[model samples]
Target: MTSTRLSVIDEIFLRTHRGYGVPIALQGVWRTTGTVSRDELVRIHDRLAVGKLGRRVGKPRIPGARLRWDLSPGSLPLECDTEAVENIVAWADAQADVPLDPQYGPGWRMTAARLAHGGTVVSLVCSHALADARGLIDAAAQSFSGSAVPEPISSPGSDAADALRMILTVLVRSIIATARLWVSARARAELRAFATSDSARTPPHRVRKMRSVVVDIDASQWDSAAEVAGGSANALFVSVVAATMAELGSPAVIVDIPFRTGSGDANSIGMATVNIRGDDSPAVVRAACKAAFAAPVGAPAGYPPEVVQLLPHRLAATLTSTPGRGEVLCSNIGEIPPALSTLGPHRSCGLATRAIHPAAIGPLPCATIRLSTYLSRMDGRYTLSLVSTDDALVESTEELTAAVHRALEKRNLAGTPW
Candidate 1:
């Protein structure tokens, strides 16, 4: 089938159903080293569409979305301008700031312009609520790598439901197992009695503006740093972010980290977004993160991996199966690929990246941060973006951005790559 409608991923669907939408964007500059062909453009479009599901049902669509690649022909030559590429790039960056229309569909847009010089700069803007930022970058890298044309149509799968399903599934099983481990018949019976007697429990808190940060480190350096610090890259990243919040005097914080989905189908990769809320104590945060990282990478190793333990089995399953869960998402789209390098003769290129928050019923933030690695002859660099709405926090957005950069710099992880 050319297209099959499936449910929107948890965060994405929620965003559209409400008024807010995801914005995914990026800009890149590539100096023309070899001949440019229309075939290359087609291939890039096909790759972009590969993973997108239908808006309503979240069903998979072959060649996911049509990409528009417009070029200013050489014949229309104006005066040769060295910074012509920069002008286009600046406009592309401005595009990233525009709000999206949730009713239209997946919030992604791209523009590629040939510069006055032989080089070119490409800009991509997307909604964060639709897909994770890293996912978008990965797809872009694959598209730009070569002229490997994708098969026009591919299988449609229910990939969006994976995150919600997996978490809920794990949660329920954990609860059942924990109950069997810790509760005796009398205790269980007494709990049941208390359940029947207690009434008027507090309402579930509304989703609030998610507070988040973005830091880019050399993907290569991350491992050694983690090993030396006796922590994983994620742990270190979170620790820095948490430390920043502490410095700001925040009593509580919620952070969501993207968990890569194992499925081969592009869409099958679910967002195992993590939340580090409910545990306000620094010791709890540090210990919980440490324990989570200790587990083998592939194994379901994080501590209390199942949250369903907190809910009844039936309810837990229902929540998992259902589309919406009021949760803030934190994700890191790891380093950009080396293939994106701009070598000699390739003078000017544009690399554009953007992030947008998802809209949900409550005030909870559907914000995210993504990083893309960049290379220059003398420097190793990456770009970081943080997406949030004014309703979510009292802190100034500039303050948050500064804190992220400061935190990353303190660890000697990132700075001006130029």
Candidate 2:
């Protein structure tokens, strides 16, 4: 029997959930040309229940021991909406309210609804503690490909013995982490100095309600605009988001880009930051992005994982600082997998992905980040999903949609709002 420990990032998310912060989850929406039969939806849900998305966290018997994953199948069933809906996007947003417990069981939920006009929309919501964008995509692809599901392996030793071994391992690793923590502290000081700049101040006005906008653009046009701007597709995406934030009155935008670290943990992406002005051209932003990506990817800035695991959840939360107002998380999911393009007998016409915070219903204690953008390409269309937590900048979904249009228009690219 083998034991898999939670990664540092995973531990952070888990701690955050247990502390004051709400558990964040990822939502994937796929639009099909026709209705996916109820039976087919059930089959898809069952397959996913047995995949990676199904697992939940298993806490150690003693503190200081790393958390493990309970590889048992998830207990969530296929949720089908009997009535047709006018707006599938709105329905998808509502699905976020559904509860998903990562530590107990059923870390994911799947729902399907038919469009008023035609077609079907199916959504899968997975707790961020269980999987990230890449992990969720892989789970779906594996399920659709008829791949064999691996059975969970039992632990070799007794529970108490396993816990004792893990605690001893943590003790040894904590000593090494202490040395590294000193080095990390110096680096963090430099980061804090940079963050204290006037441009990094929080934006004015605070509102609690979060709004999101989804738009679809022609893939050819998007690619052409990127080429004409002398930048790649990714550069264009960053430029658009930066420009949009700037137009919304953010002086400078600190973009957080997520890259895969080739880890099997729930949150395997390493974060890289790039600061840009609204007036920066796509080419300039491209160069900055390239440099940022080339920089080393490591643990997030905070207390070391070993140190955090030893502390209480509330204490760990107190030590971690809130993100700056100018910060914007930009995730480019790239292309949709072919296996996900077809669900049962229906082919997907569009795909939209975004992260939702179920507990963020009112104003947060601190100023929220300005915006978050998620980009994905499916079929011949590019779906650009935007979420604004700062109500001051984006008062409503209509305002965000208009801002997206203007931003894309500036780049000679146009998209239809979803």
Question: Please, what is the TM-score per model?
Answer: 0.52, 0.86
lDDT of each prediction vs. the true structure? 0.40, 0.74
Residue-wise C-alpha lDDT for candidate 1, range 3-69, written one tens digit per residue: 2222224233333344333223333333353334445544455455443321222322223221111
* lDDT (Cα, tens digit) per residue for candidate 2, span 227-277: 988898989999999888877877577888887777756677777778888
Where does the lowest 10-residue lDDT sum fall in candidate 2? 317-326
Indicate which candidate wins on lDDT: 2
Q: Quote model 2's TM-score.
A: 0.86
The per-prediction CA RMSD against the true structure, in angstroms, equals: 10.3, 3.8
- Residue-pair clashes per candidate: 44, 0
What C-alpha lDDT, on a 0 to 100 scale, does residue 334 get in candidate 1? 51
Model 2 steric clash pairs: none
